[model samples]
Target: MILDLNQFVSKERPYWDELTAVLKKQEEQPDWKMSLPEARRFHYLYQRASSDLVKLKTFAGEVEVAQFLENLVARSYSRLHEKRGSTIPFRPVHWFLRVFPSTFRRHWIAFMISLFSFLIGGLFGAGVMKFAPQHKTSFIGSFSHLSGKPSDRVAKEEKKQFDGFERRNTFSAQLMANNIRVTILAMVVGVFFGIFTVFLLFYNGIILGVVVFDYIADGQGVFLTGWLLPHGSVEIPAIILGGQAGLIIAHAMFGWGTNLRLAQRFRRIRSDLLTIVGGAALMLVWAGLVESFLSQYHGPTVYPIKIAFGVLQLIALICFLLFAGRTRQPDSIHAG
Candidate 1:
């Protein structure tokens, strides 16, 4: 299995035969498999090799598949030194990571995993939050309550601010940051038996799932979701992502894969999680602002304004994400 192979044979001959063989077999795998480790391996290899493959597949001057044979030869030689711990003059992984998001999209499992966690956790969290006593005390550890403020203070203030929202809406950099924050909170809450993340999700979920309930509870659901929708849509995803990041850490700590390498995996993953957390923080402020000022201030007459702004933010988000793949590598290296 090329998955079992590390790199190429040597600089003179990368592992083309093995890689090609594996790619051929990999092409037959279910679409979801494209996200798995084996599929990832192929993606990595093929992406590097694609330029040559394209030549053979298309723009050849009536050249045969043998024209693509160079990659095989180059890869074979590259694998030689790679396996032996010698320099194969191979391209660095960072080079390809620049395209990782688009490249990794073929691996739909990651998204499915993320969304599945969001749905299950969000609903579960919502149910527990909606029905559970809001004033109950924990049996262990320390409680971090609001200082000199009622539990409802933050929410009420948030509502007040929403009723008076305004901002120089840029590229929804605020929303991106919001995505990062919600995702982080979701993850950080995992530190408490993951119940916290669940509750957090549940809190938001019920708040989201039953807007009518919120309106009924205080005649504020419409305003809440609306103000929230301006940024909640962005902020919530970030928090969910944060929660997912937390779960990843928890799993690594618990030796999800194996005991021998659990710590090693944690070490490997810590930075990635932190980046996710930081990104989450950035998203929250933006989303929070939308909730605080713009969304709330826009009355029924402001519905059109909200729609127009929301669409703009949505478009801006897609554009930023499109560029994120390119940015990820540079950011990661700087992070490292």
Candidate 2:
């Protein structure tokens, strides 16, 4: 049952006010330290405010009350989670384990859109190659190296790139640079209303689909899979996450039919964008390393090993996003 706004606010206002005061004090005087009793009081007040916010969300026609609680709770949450010079420090690990996964969980819908966008583009490119072979060159121009079936020369070139430590290091650096450049471009371009971000993702997906389609159509599907999956398993997801981040930034600006003020929307996006971009960049680095070191070692004996490792990497990525930070402090603000 929904309580009357008057009654609910009358009951919860004290706690909310107390939390707001504590957060305000922290913001106004960053160097000020909270005593043991004050810290306990702040925690109690924050928990009460969080509980009231949940109740407010469940009831309709309480927009003003809900908005107040939302802002208050978010501010209080940020204050409590802020780094302190205590023995139990909590900034570095907090971002990866708490903020990143929470952001991922919150924006899953955007991620799905990103995934589908890429898949649709890839399928369209594949169709162009398969149905209208004349336009294949247009779609697969620079990536022609990956097309028209496999050859010994191509295999030897791949091996040569990874044959030595110096070459492998150089290749890894190049891979990271290229992937990070694409990821950053995808994310930053969203500021232009996200149109270019969409085009960039589609272009990347088209290239991938065209190459894969060519290999499969030429009866080199298995070899191509072995060569691609090791690094691509992580690389593709990283790119999709970058797109998700960009879409989020764009959505904040375009309103998406929300009633939030510009400041509110910007705050939400700012909180999430850092964690999303940071996580994606980390994944790209890992993908680059794997691509340079492990992806080029293809053979009857090595192929299954690489594929198995790739599967494990994908599983680990999924598990981290779904499960990490689940056991965080109860009062931590829910990301979104």
Candidate 3:
């Protein structure tokens, strides 16, 4: 076979340069994390450069070009292999501020599906309550307290004084435990192809919708907002995150877009699953504390302040999920 070395070198030089630039950036930012597309591109460039090195070695006249290719291949090889070989120590701040949110963004579509399912359930429940008020007991039967009029509950709650610190702490702990259990169940049930996950989310949303509609219809909307928004804002989103994680697991189970084996798919998503669930758990803890200490309180004097606080917290959370851990530019590979 005849070889055109000059043409081959010209064709591949751009790739070589691009790979060099990527390697340089990686060297500069040891802790930088690449998106999946960027990672794939990096791997492709590495393999291509390695192949170029082999072909160059076959024709011995271009010693300089061959050495350059060899060095580029070696650097990429070391960078790639060292990461797999090494253990990166966990940094809580970094994980919370970057890893968790970035992962949430990565699978935003799943989160949207989870959210949409919940909203649909909420609408259905609200419709039932609005038109068929007699069936309210079917949904609120589990909570004997909510069976009464919302105005009555609000009046009774406002008349009561704040419970002591010890009682509130105990209540907070109990709330945290219950919420965490529910959230974990939402995630673990993804093993059943996420069917149960969607059901759990929908069911919870139904209960919420029923309660909200009941209160609003009775003209207790202010009380409901003051009572729930403080903690419910964070708590509801946390549960949705659980649903998100569940859907992710379901996707892996289905092996939607790849030919990877079942075990391989699960392995790839394991870290992301852990990060999401862990973040949701933390949010639940905060929600529980707020529910016990602040949300349980009710009065005209405190309602406005509580509503403001809840709104601000919710805005902060949305911003964090949308923008946190976002880099100035993606680490993309292009011809240099």
What local distance difference test score does each model get? Answer: 0.52, 0.82, 0.90
Which sections of candidate 2 miss by over 4 Å? 1-90, 151-162, 328-336
Tens-digit per-residue lDDT, 254-280, candidate 2: 988899997899787886887898888
RMSD (Å) of each candidate, 1 decimal: 18.6, 12.9, 12.7
lDDT of 2 at 201: 87
Considering summed lDDT, which 10 consecutive residues are worst modelled in model 3?
79-88
1-336 in candidate 3: lDDT tens per residue? 434888998899899999999999989988777788998899999999988877777754577888898899999998878654257888999999999999999999989989988998898789989999788889879889898888889889899876665589999999999999999999999989999999999988888889999999999988888889999989999999999999999999999889999999999999999999999999999999999999988899999999999999999999999999988887789888
Report the alpha-carbon TM-score of model 1 versus the true structure.
0.44
Best prediction by TM-score:
3
| Model 3 global lDDT (CA atoms, 0 to 1) | 0.90
Off by over 4 Å in 1: 1-185, 189-195, 212-225, 258-260, 326-336
> Taking the candidates one at a time, how many backbone clashes does each contain?
47, 0, 0
The TM-score obtained by model 3 is 0.73
lDDT of 1 at 259: 56
Residue by residue across 233-334, what tens digits does model 1's lDDT show? 666655665665666666666665575685687687675566555555655776766755565464555666776677678677656545546533454444
Name the weakest run of 10 consecutive residues (lDDT summed) in model 1. Answer: 1-10
Winner by lDDT: 3
